[model samples]
Structure formats: structure tokens, C-alpha cells
Target: MAEGGTTLEFTPTWVVAVVCSVIVIISLAVERLLHFAGKYLKKKDQKPLFEALQKIKEELMLLGFISLLLTVFQERINKICISENWLRNFMPCKKPSDDKDEGTTAHFQTFFSPPVLPATVGRRLLSEDSSAPTYCSIKGKVPLLSTTALHHLHIFIFVLAVVHVTFCALTILFGSIKIRQWKHWEDSAAQKNYNAEDVLQKKFTHVRDHDFIRNRFHGFGKSVAVLGWGHSFFKQFFGSVTKSDYITLRLGFVMTHCRGNPKFNFHKYMMRALEADFKKVVGISWYLWLFVVIFLLLNVAGWHTYFWIAFIPFTLLLAVGTKLEHIITQLAQEVAEKHVAVEGDLVVQPSDEHFWFNRPKLILFLIHIILFQNSFELAFFFWILVQYGFDSCIMGQVRYIIPRLVIGAFVQFLCSYSTLPLYAIVTQMGSSFKKAIFDQHIQEGLVGWARQAKKNKGLRKAANGNSAGSPPGAAAVQMTKVREEDALLRSQAKGTEIVTDQRSNSSS
Candidate 1:
């Protein structure tokens, strides 16, 4: 702060980001340890550790709220830097110059003619005579920021992003191929033809079948859910909502909801569902959490360029993973509940309260797309801005270029804040369309399969119609007994008394 050409007054955001990031990092580490410990604990029948794992997961997910803020603000950081540059450029006009020549008027004209941005302003503040620099960076101003600069920045960042995406896309393709090869090496495996829709269907199917591997796969969800919840809790607690009042209101609502329904089971079901979902996505894994922390570490460790781009991937990966997890979990739960109902469990019937709120997990996936697409793109531009300073390409150009930078930053926010919500809505609606397509197939397939199974069972019963399981003559007697029993049950339900003369006399 002291050495920097211009010292910016500490913004509340700085305190929030640093403090929250550190807490999130600690939470992530603890989550990782808990997960690793739980894996071994569950195997070895260590119940206490298993329970602790569950508690940790709950907290971690609750904290993932910070991650959302982190995502929101990381993009804005470059703006702050740029703004400082803006301030520095304007500040030098106030400082009086001692080495005044008759051409001091010429010098003043030269400065005003060149730019009104930080690159030019910064050079004046830090360089003294433009020889060498002492600090990590210098403040500079150029010409007022403009349209050409904005468009140019956009084009430059977009090209870099296109390259980054291309690489990741190639990596995904290569990774998929490797997976196929690995599967082929297994017992009796053969190459299967795949359609894109079918492949997507299968991916969703894996999510659908998540519970089949729940004991193994659930850790991932539990991890994210807890982090998300915890992040939210702290944000509300320390920063905005005034903690104790919030808690009181939360509990009051919970108590009020539980007031009439003497049946706590319904309430329990809703709470459990919320916990499972929230924790699972945000809490159940530490990979992306670790990634974000590690990426920031690189920046703090002196790789200034890493900070801007890294946030994109970290945000994308978390969002995508969270969406996939939530959707699959919900679908899987639905499937399980369907089977449970078929087996005649009254308790498994859908609660009326739940029906109103039970949105499909596909919303999660949609959210990730919204988050990563814009955030990732922004990361690219931010890196470019950082590069603009480091590479010395914007000094003389700064006077011409600073206006564009400011405008672009504002545009970034406007585009993101609006586009993200719109994307979420459209994608979620699209997922609904996809679900309708899949559900039609699933309904037909299951009905047909069930019919065939029933038919096969009937055929087997007929084949053994007189087997020792029934006995030849005894089958008729058994049928007669069954008919009599049905009649008796009907009569009892109707409250009718059969008045046989002998039975009547005995009763009299």
C-alpha cells in the first residue's frame, strides 16, 4: 500500500474476499480429510468417523455460498485495478512540478494530448524518468477509455478464450477415447455404436442410476452441498442479514410449519431432502474447491496472470459438477420412490407440500452453464487487461485506449447479470423438453418390460398348475377355499349375518 504509486482505500470487498477465501480453503481441506477418513472408516466399521463425515459435509455445503461471491467478484477485480489506474492518471495533475522550464506549458500540453488513463498516469507516478521499476506493477493512464478499445479488448480476449476452449475440448475428446479403450480391455466388452442423444441419455442415465452406486458416489454431492450451505450461512451471518435475527426467523418458520402436522415424518422428509441435495453438490467433494484454492495460490505465489483465467475453470467445473449431481440425484430418488410405491408403501406417497417445490435436478445443470459460460469468458478478458499493463503495449495507446477498458468492464457486468439468469431459464426449460422426450421412452419401456415379466410368470404358473406345489385334486379344493374366504371377507365388510336355521336356533 505504501510503495504503490497510488494507494486505494481498502474496500469492504477486499476484506470479504480474503477472509472468505481463507475460510473456504480451510473448509475444503477439512472436507478432504474427512472424506478420506470416512472412506476408510466405513470400510472398517468406524461409526464415529462416519458420523463426523456427515456433519462435516453438512457444514461445508453451507459455506459454499462464499464460492458464489468469489465467482461474482473475481471478475470485478481487474476493474478495481483499472479504476485505480483511472484515479492515478487524474492524481498527477494535482502534484506541482519543481523542474519547470519555459516549456512547462509544452509539457502540460504533451501530457493532456497523450492520454487520460493509468498507463500514462502510472508512468508519471512510478518511473520518474522511465528507466526501471521497483514494485510488482506501476500505475499508468492513457487517453480516455473508448469504443475501439472496448471492441479491441473483446476481440483479443475472445480469441484467447476460443483457444483455451479448443484445448479443453480436445482434452475431453481424448479423455473419452481413453475411457472407451479402458472399457474395451475389460471382460467380454465390445465397441458399441453411439448417438449423441443416446450418449447424453446414458450420461443422464448414469445420474439416474446414481443411487445404484450411492454408497460410493454420494460423497461428491455431500461435499458440495455442505460447502454451498456454509458459505451462505457466513455471508448472511457476518455480512448482510444480521445473524441472530435471521436465525430466529428461520427457527420461527420451522416451528410454525411443524405446528399443525403432528406427523413429523413429512417435515423430516423435506428437511432430509434439502440437506441431501444442498450438501451433496457443494460439500461431497473437494476437487474443485481444492482447484480454486490452488489456482489462487499460484497468483499469490507470484503468477499474476493465473488469477484471472483460473477463476473461470474453477467456477465452471464446480457449477457443472453441481448441476450434474443435483439432477441425477433427484432423478435417482424419483426412480427409487416409484419402486417403493409399487411395493405398496403408503408412506412413500408424495406429500402435497413437496409437490409444489419438487423441481427437477436439471436446474442445477442449467445453473452451471450460466455460471461458467460468462464467468469463463470474463476470465479471458481480465487476463488480457493484466497483460496490457505487463507487456507495455498500452502506454502511448493508453490515452486512446483507457475509455474502452472502463466501458468494456461495465458492459461485462451488464451482459453477465442479465444473460446468466436468462440462460438459466432457457436451459432449464430446455432440460424439461429433454426430460419429456426421455420420460416417454422410459414409461413405455418399463410398462412393456413389466407386462412381459408378468406374462412369463403366468406361463410358469400354468406349467406347474398341477405340480406338487399345488397337487392335482387339492388344487380344486384350494380354489374352493379361496372363493369361500373371499365371500366371508365380503360378508364381514357388509355387516351381513347369514341366517342358517340351525345356526339361528343355536344363537337364540
Candidate 2:
């Protein structure tokens, strides 16, 4: 941790040392076994208590482990990463350093300023003199974010993730049981109040396509007034941490959307109408795969440290991709509703309004906004790389700068170009989906309207004619009123059924 001193050798021993000192694996196992045995001895009548107890146990166990981890690393990564320079760099408003360390004298507050490495956390850009030596320019202590808006945002995402995961897991467990119950009921197959297939489908579909973000956002918004600062407490408990599993939602969404795409990508017409649907999920898959691959490649290529650091972008791609995919699906679904029928639960989730608007101009505007966001993301990542490069550069540790840049540029070109394949598929998929739905829905509605109009004309004629055996005026009036009501009802029943039907199918 000194200039001109050998770099700190981080090894398994060092890692173990950094981890908690007291390992009580046997005691925890024994306690868990005893708890399980006690539950097994009890009758099933009091399951809710057991369930609640189990949940509490889980939470406590989690808190205990996390507390220990944080305590161990409190003097290392967290303190440094939360340093004033670090937070200010990523999070715009936070102070670079704290006013004073917690419960410390002004004399001793500065006592534990960890010796930072030569480079900062974020990367830099590649320009002229990029190879020039760089050093750890930043100094001083980090301020604890106790706490700020970014903390809230992080907390929000974390809580969202937890609730999302919990909901999903619950759906799977309970839903499977529900399906079996329905199946058992179906075996008897008499006067069944439940449509087993429909109910099952709805249950499964609901599980599959759970809207984690919108639900959490709405949940947060509703509770904001009542909870006051208490909201942050929940956020800290549930949202302060995120795991990669949050991605499982997006992968499912992509697959769900893929079900509706067109069938053929002919050798003759690779970009043909239906062929694009096949590629839509493929595009998303590429990014997901890219993240996995890049992380490993970096690790194997002697930049093992880069794996976790690069995860920020990988995690962003997974998370944001899921968020955006859901947004786009919803927008299309809404558009589907508007085209086929006027009476709709057309409440667009407000957070998604900007990105998921169906209007052409709105989409273009959104595209620009997304581009800017993407650029910022890339720039920040590049800066991270640059910062690392600068760490190596500043430390004068770079072995061969020019060669590294060439290889890096070449790799970036590949990464940047990766979109061509995904874009081709996504564009094809999105457009194909639009076209198919357009033809199947809007066009179908128009044709139905024409057919209905014709049928009404025939009915009117019949009503007016003597063969109907009713007064002409009364017959016409009744027919007209019935037709109007039918039309309205028919209009209200489009995406509502589809969403409901899909949810039922998947969750069941």
C-alpha cells in the first residue's frame, strides 16, 4: 500500500482473512435441523405461523451473514468505494468526502484514510497521448452515504428486486400446487366451477410475466405519503443489495415475446417479413451472452479483477434490457388494444410512458433519449476502463500500451458490431410482430366492422320486411340497439383477454 512498494498480493489466504473470523457452520446447521424437526412435529393447522417464522428466520439469517460481511470489509472496499471521490464520480450530488467520520474526534477522523491504489474505479477515454503515464490522482477519506437520493435509488432497485424475486418464487411454489389441485379436481370432471385449463394458464402466465418494476414503482409511489422516511428503512432492508438473478425476469419476457414472431428466415430473403421474429429474442440473447463472455474472457486474459468491475455494464444490460423489453411489450399491447377496441384499461404505467409510447414521433424521440443514455453508459464504462488503464498507466505498469489499445479497439469493434446481428433480429422481430398483429388485429377489426355492417344491413331489411312478423319500427329499433351494444362489448374484449389468457396459461 505504498508508492514503489510491491503491490498487495491478494490470495485465497488474504480473501479468507478479509472474510469473517468466526466460522460457526456446525451450530447453524444444528439449529436449522432442530427448527425443522420442531415444525415437522407440529400439525398443519398452524402453517401460517410456521411460514411467518420461516420467513423471519430467513431474513435474520441473511441479515446476520450480511452484517458479518460488511463488518469485515468495512475497513476495506466499502469504505474506499464509498469514498467522496468514488461516490461523487458515479453519483452526481454526494460529497466527495465526509464532513467528519462517525463518532470520531476531528483529531482522529482522518486516522484511517486507506492508502488508495494509483487508479480510481471508473474508466477513462482513449485519445491522443492515451498511453501516457497516469497515477492515482484522488486522495482523502470517503464519506458514508448516510444517506442520499442515489442511496434511495439503489435502495429502490434493491427492494424491487427482492419483492420481484419473492413474488416469483411464491408464484412458482403455490402455483404448482394450485395446478395440481386443479388437475385433481379435473380427474373427477363433473360440474367443475373452475375451468382448469384457463385457470392454470392464467396462474402460470402471471408468474412468468410478473411486472417487477411497474409493480414496485407503483408500490413505492403509493406508500411514499404514508411511510415517509420509513420507506427508506424498508429500502435499506430489501433494496440495498441486488443479485444477478434479477435478470431471470428479462429472459422470460424475451422468450414470451418470441412466441408471437413470424416463422421464416429464408436463405433467399433473410430480412423477410416473418423471419424477423426469430431474431428479436436473439438480439437480447446476444447482449446477455456478451456480458457472460466478456466477464470470463477478462478473467482468463489475466485481468481477473475486471470480471466483477465489468459486471456493472453487464448487470445494466440485463436489468435495463428487461425493463425496456417489458415497456415495449406493454406499449405494443396498449396499441393492440386501441386498434381493436376503444374500451380498454389503457393506463400506461407512467414511468414507461416516455419509452413505450406508440405514436411515431414519440418513438423517435424515445430513440434519441435512449441513444443519449446508451452513450452515457458507454462513456462511463470506457472511463472505468480508462481509469484502470490510468492506474496501470499512472503506475507506469503498462507493459505494452500500443498493442493493448489495438487489441482493445479490435475487441470493441467486435462488441460494437455485435449489435448488427441483434439489431437485424430485433428490428425484424419488432417489425414482424407489429405487422402480424396489425394484420391479425386492426385489419381483422376493420374487416369485422365491414362484415358486421353488411350483416346489419341484411338484418334491417329483414326487420323491415313482412316475413319477420313484427312491427317494422319496433324491430328496427331493437336490432339497432342490440347491434350497438354488441359492438361496444366486442370492442372491450381484446388485450384484456390476451393478457389474462397468457397469464393464466403460464402461471397455471
**Pick by lDDT: which candidate is best?**
1
- The TM-score of candidate 2 is 0.22
User: Candidate 2's residue-wise lDDT over 1-508, tens digit each?
Assistant: 2233222353357656555444556656857885985577345433323444455445446545655664454334333334444432222111224433221111111112222222321111111012323222133444342112122223322332243233323322342332233232222322323332332243322222334333332222435534423432243222221211122222222233433321111111212222222222112123432643443233222233332343343333333333333343443344333343222112222232323343322332322223222332333234434323343221122443333334433322322222222222223223223433232344455566667767767776666674378777888787787588568746655644465346433422
lDDT of 1 at 471: 65
Runs off by more than 4 Å, candidate 2: 1-304, 307-378, 381-412, 415-432, 436-479, 485-508
lDDT of each: 0.35, 0.34
Error of 2 at 194 (Å): 51
Give candidate 1's error at residue 86 in angstroms: 7.4
TM-score of each: 0.25, 0.22
